[model samples]
Target chain A: MDAREDRGQQDISGIYRMYSKEVYQYLYHFIGSREAAEDLTQEVFVRVIKSLHRFEERSSMRTWILHIAKHVAIDEYRKKRLQTIFAGTLLKLLPSTEGLPEKELQDKEERTHFEKALLQLKPKYRNVIVLRGIREYTVKETAEILGCTEAKVKVDFHRAMKMVKEVALHIYEKGAGVNEIS
Target chain B: MKFPSDEEVLQEFRNRPDAVPRSEFLHTLERKLVEVEQQHRSRSKMRRTTIRLGLSAAVLLAVFFLAPIFTRLITHPESIMTTKPEAPLVLKGQQLKLAEVSPAVKQTLEKLFNLVPELKTMEPKVIGKEDGVYEIVFYQKEQGKEQRYVSVEMVAATGKISNYENEKAMNEEAPSPTEEEAKQMSAAFLQALLGDEFKQYQVSQNANNDWSSVAYTRYENGLPVFLDRYYVGVNSKGVTYVNTPEGAQPPVSSEAFPKPGTFLSEEEVIAKVASLIELTYSLEKDTGKPLLTYSLETTGYFHAETGEDVESVSSHTSRYSDVISVKPGGKKLAARDADEVAKVMAEEFGIDMNGVSFEADERILPDKKGVEGTLYKSSGGTEKIMVYTNNKELTGFQIRGKIETASSTQHDNKPANAKLTYEEAKEKAVQFLEPYLDSSVKELKIDESQIMMPTSTAYSFSFFALHDGVVVTDQNYLVNVDGQTGQIVNFMDNFMKPIGPFPDLDTAISREEAVKQFLQSHPVELGYILPVEKETLQLRPLPVYSVDTRAYFLLDAISGKLVK
Candidate 1:
């Protein structure tokens, strides 16, 4: 490694210290847990490092970093999906509810409802909704980060939101909570 | 109702964009790039060297000569080029393991401290990243039966109990035990702390072949006892339980424990009442003149020689309109009505109630007629009760009386008394804090000075000091003990260090200036009207700002209640 590489490394390190927290916050909203967020953030940077040489000054450095972030996030989503499938089957086989029969039944019902709504979202729509709703990303910034136009981001975000709302309304119509027919 | 338009939502998004890194994210990418480059360089170097030296032969020779060296390098980096790997750390002198804990030890812990039932499988968590030392944790229910967790840290490297902490001991009143009960509890706690020794006296065996020990000691009451029990071991590294005796040796310290006292005083009680009243009023803000009713409660009575109404009332309140029938220092009891009074007599006097046995005292203060006192005395103890009259009869005229009027009128017979000044009050509070004050505490700081009162000045003092590896701040309380009659009228101490500090609002020329100054350059926006004034001891108010996507800021000023 030469001084020029070292200099380049310094510049990259400087950028990381500044944005690590913001990026971590984004991952935390989607994943939860400080430890997981840090791991994801590190993975995001690893990918960013791999792709840094390929980065042409086509987009601003911020937009480029976010593009890598979007890919990393998608990868995390895939990994989580596989994990969820495994947990779902294993949980199903477990003695339905652990202890305190009445309370466990109620908790399981609520948890199932929540998981159903979360799973209903399409991957593309889920990405937008999670970024917009959970990670608290702005439509314009999310679009920029996702490499889509702002208007496209908005349309997709609304469509995803509509999907969530529809699921909720259907649950209500079906009477899931109290006073509703099971 | 229509949901937000896509455009409107997008606008909100643009304004408060998600918590994505703006520019600093590139640094992580850069570091990774460097790491990848280093890895590539190393791989190429290995490849070139292998090709030059004939890969197969060189690889075999290197492996034969350097395998131990490589392992040493990885495990003991400092010793790689210097010396052979040292022997594995051997914990000696009273070292014990979970498999070794006796049934006697387990029984003692269970009986004494009511530890969580999952004691057998529990493992200690290592504290520091570098150190392999571990600590054991146990939990018990505290006041209100709230679960409080305690940790007994064992230094694994040394096989020593590093520390023991009763997590909620600082906040809640300690449970009182009889001399014998206290001794038993202490013995059990010590046994749990000293894992292996406590386990050795087990008389019983379990299905898994695990056994318990029973060590006997004379009860603190010096009663003759005959019982043997088994103790259970905590874990692999058992140094955390240092206080346990090796055999049946008893504890040396039989020092009489001081009785616990309530955290609240007269002013604190009033403050608590006021806070509760304010909350009730806020909830029913729309209702005009809503009558707020709550229960007045009391607990902990001091035993009197006469044994009538218990003496030295530990705590009292006027929220309930109960008759004080009897006082016995122990479990809290209240009499709200005639039936309650009858129940109290039936329970306390050991005689069946003949309907209601007592009547409410209706003594209105002569100076302040709105305030009424209801004092009751039995052959055992005397109980004092005060009631506030909300009706406009106290100040003689209908002058839309303030809450202060009610307080002033209530204690007319309790004359004005001189006590500690602000400085003196702080001194006294610190003096009272001798046992709990951490060694690092430099001095007490008067966080709050003057408090307005209708009859006397109420003051607040906050004491702070950094001690015992952490900062210590607690409400140091003091009040005027009436010189003539020694009745505590007012008290205050809501002092802890402010969370951080609010930036100087004046230094900034514009709204952006204030936000940037305090929040370190995060986005800013106009926050909603906050009702609570920032306390002097509080850190800066939450920076209500737009980060381009989220409309969020801290809600509570004291702890920085971010809306997230």
Candidate 2:
């Protein structure tokens, strides 16, 4: 490879090393599937490699990469609708929060319920929660990634938190007896 | 049950197991990147070689065939050097997968299949041309002894199930769920789609039978957010359909909108609304009867600070008008006259007005009193422009079609000295609009002006139109000037001609008395209130009010009574 191409590859490798885990976690929480998240992470890197030269530095590199990751996840979602159908079923088959102490199990269950609730939320809401709440990015940073105003990011983050709280509370109180459509 | 704090929620999320990629993921990615780089380099090399060979061949051919070609170019320069037309800026619908359309839709289908495991055997097919909606159909299949067929129409825009149909027959002995049961079922379904906060949406059943529908509206801080609502339908089989607004979500913040202080008493608010009311008339469709309608001339959301409504940032120009072409009645202009105007539109704006029908209507212009204009509507019903017959002046026009090309000569040529200061652009805009500024044009103020920097820089100026001293809530004009030449690139004037015998301002009811009358009827209900911001692609949160009924109505200034 040419020296310039070799330098470009090195830059891409450095970016992947710094961001792959963060991007994967964000996509995982969003799509509720590790397999899909991993696949989309690769796609995100591929896109980053392709568009890296054209990136005008309008936002920070982290925010720009996250933005690309978001698009990749959304595009993958559109391409694999049926695979998403199996995500919940696979999640349900996971081993119960047993063998642990009562309090630990309860906490685990609540966390699991919150994750499910996160999946239930609209994509926009989920985006704010993942970036601002879970990742603990600043509202400005989240806005840059989401391509929205900081005020909007703050508002959505607040609302998403309320929703997560409500969902977790409802699930904890009701248990698994909540109606499942037949 | 108490809700978890934001900290606790975040901690819970953080506690969840991290999704680490497989160990070989990076190795695989590195290999893929190498492959991509090789492919890109080879393509670039091939392109360069092809260009070099093509240039050499062209140079040799030009030497041999130069005389005739040069002569032809000199004879008809326009034919060989015509500019390519710019493609129209159209918002093409995106192809979407079901999951991408809405997470709730995917979850609902998964839940349905899980509940009826046999249905899983029949593959579901989702079809859609739009980005935010899709149709998923599952064909009837014989599973041992039973057959089932189901179809769901999902709208991802609103994250609501628009429709669901079960084509199989079930035993009549198994009755449908009661209205209460249906409400519970619908709530569960919404919770699955919208999360726990959606529980605030109280379901009110409209009908209780084999086919039943329940409307859901969210209540925050005791007051209802009436802006968005969801309708869920239940049949004997199960929950059949749900209709929701696009990007509908419950209020995010409970902080009282227009923070609770002494707001204008009901009496004062009523008076403000009454003073703003406009007396208008609308013709009955069937009888052509002119019915007097009192319109609340308020703009935007009701703000507590000023006790007066704020202006909406989004442009909604075509809604308010005293005279609309109802039946295409007036003196019909000659076809040639229509064609003459249509030719200007075709040549200048790239509007294909050929073979299109035309109608003339008498418009009551504030300046001209009564003027007749010809209206040409495109076949798609998207583009409509009206030109006066007497003066041949363009009056009203609405183009919903995509802008296909830079239709103006000023935009075609780039002038080296075309850089104009903001002051110069404003001066040019004023000069262009000076003819339309009459005594009736009150408070001619610039609403907004911005310099758009891109391929061709231009300054867009939006001017608000006011009547008398009050803001003419619906009337405004927008003009765009070329940054370099100071030439007008685009212009739109949406000022409605009021049919007057205008009412005297001094004769209006007192603000205090009007507010008193308004309070007596519309009691205050507490809810959240969100101020409207300028148009953006992001989803905006709605405002909520505490101890605010959130009801707004216009009152007739003369009578101090609510306008129906």
Candidate 3:
């Protein structure tokens, strides 16, 4: 209705071009599956667009974008947790690379023990490792995204790392690949 | 199974593949945003008009009068508005409903509808957007059969049309344009869509696609860039689909591209490697027959600047070997001795024979001296390291794991969670190999250029042996570090321990005579080939004029006669 709004409009594409990659990288390590990460990354940007007008100058755009992404990841984890009743135990028996294409299978093949060990972590630990360990975000930034204090972020991240080693040893002892030890 | 430090685990996480979002994913999101922008604009306009009218009754009256225009829009859309796909894109707390196409997006839609009148009845809607570029989908189900459609993706900012597809024309068995007529129509469509930008590209002669499709290559520096070609598919119903490539390439200034005279021509390059071919015989696989053919061989690339063959990349590092001060013991040892070799292996190489058995196996080809097969566990075990020697002088040794087959994709080659970088893996390889080195052999030099690459896993270090700093070329060791565990899972040495004093390498005949004699038997055959350099992950696309004598060996340095 206003000419000023028409003359110099800010659209979602600009926001997407700037922040989509950062959100995708953050979500990818969190979810462990690229397909799910892609879907959730799109969902994050969609939420960003709908709330673009509501954005305040209080937080850096990067922080605001990732804050939205954290919610999407946690929500996805919750959904997967519910699906775990059927998709959980059965998925462990079958090889994850069973029917993937050669290139995709090769790519999945190289994901370090961290992904396999990360799967063994609870959502709380997974979030900490994904942000602090994989993405290498600062404690303050992690705290900001997680909506927790910096001290809590540091404590949780330390505890989460200990669990990774424990799980890694368990997987190695079980002779199941770190990739498959649920 | 030892897990690495937390830093290593974190590095592995960072190294995870497919970390970036797919370009197609970005494109899809761009479209969604475009639809949203249009909707927001429309909803705001609707709200403004409803408030000005001052009543729900007035809004109903406005809808009744606009009904006729809406009816016409559904048929031919002389005037039309775009909307969101799926459910009404209304949000809670926002209280927004209905959206008008943003001004720029509406202009793009109207332009496309005008360009292709058939698009009006097809319910054209912008389904995607990026940076003001709107991707619109238009279609109407064929009266009875499954729905077939067309899409017009318009770049509103640049007015560049990506593709205009018509599944109705493609799927239906209607009359179609001939290959030549299709080419003309394809060119016409590009000109119509791109306007002045159409002059920048020309029709490609390399049209390998089916008759219905035509290709055009963009020109830079007055020469066609075949790599930047685009294809347009046309049929009787105008254009069906244009294969438009996505993503923007970094802009290269005109000066960065070489002018015509700067690079060697294909003909000039091929001339550099051309030599008289000698008649040879090649076996036919199907008939189990030999067919006579002319052959000459060398591997190289035609340098763009010189118009000459630049030899293909190989292990250029000086081999590691004994210093010149050390002299060979005596005459060469022809007879094989198992006990002495085992003694040398145990002492010099640090191999333990307390629980291992040595069986002499001469079945291995090439090496005149038979191999000393050292099997682990005495009785038997899969973990074994075989040692080879020309008499007391050790030639080479190789390590084999239980399931380390070449084709095996298990933990054999996959980088274990240990997370070893190239430098770290190399350190582990050197540590595993330190115990095996001896006095006669000079220090090992890893072919840094040919380290872990393309393989993704397994740091295969080819440590060439040198004598007085000169690469023996023939004498080298291979140590493959397990990509996963950083463990030295494979080791092989092709260094033949010199049993006798070295011979002077002077040939009986001169270089010219040697070449003449060699050409008399196997003449030179020169042709262009893509000499794939294994040092990098991607193959160089440039084809070089070089000889491929992969199956043929060169003349013997001593006798000056062809070896193969």
Q: Give Cα distance to truth, residue B179, candidate 1, Å.
A: 92
Estimate, for each residue in A1-182, the C-alpha lDDT of model 2 and write its tens digit. Answer: 44434445445655766687778888876777766777778788778866665443335678899999988776765676523353375456344544545544454466567766676566788789888877667676787798654556877888877876676567677763232211
Per-residue C-alpha lDDT of model 1 across residues B159-198, encoded as one tens digit per residue: 4333344444434443433223332444455555445333
What TM-score, to 2 decimals, does candidate 3 have?
A: 0.33
Q: Which candidate is the best by DockQ?
A: 3
Candidate 1's chain A scores what TM-score? 0.64
Off by over 4 Å in 3: A1-182, B1-176, B208-210, B244-421, B427-485, B489-564
> Residue B159 in candidate 1 has what lDDT?
40
TM-score of chain A of 3: 0.75
Evaluated on CA atoms against the true complex, candidate 3 attains a DockQ of 0.15
DockQ of each: 0.03, 0.10, 0.15
Docking class of 1: incorrect
> What does DockQ come to for candidate 1?
0.03
Candidate 3 lDDT over A30-126, as tens digits, reads 7666667778887887677656544432245677889999888878777765223323432442235554455434433333344566776776787
Q: Fnat of the models, one by one?
A: 0.07, 0.27, 0.39
Ranking by lDDT: 2, 3, 1
Mind sharing the TM-score for model 2? 0.38
- Which 10 successive residues of model 2 chain B have the least lDDT summed? B323-332
Ranking by DockQ: 3, 2, 1
Q: What are the runs in model 2 whose C-alpha is more than 4 Å off? A: A1-182, B1-109, B114-119, B122-200, B205-212, B219-229, B235-237, B246-388, B391-426, B436-467, B471-485, B489-501, B512-524, B529-543, B546-556, B559-564
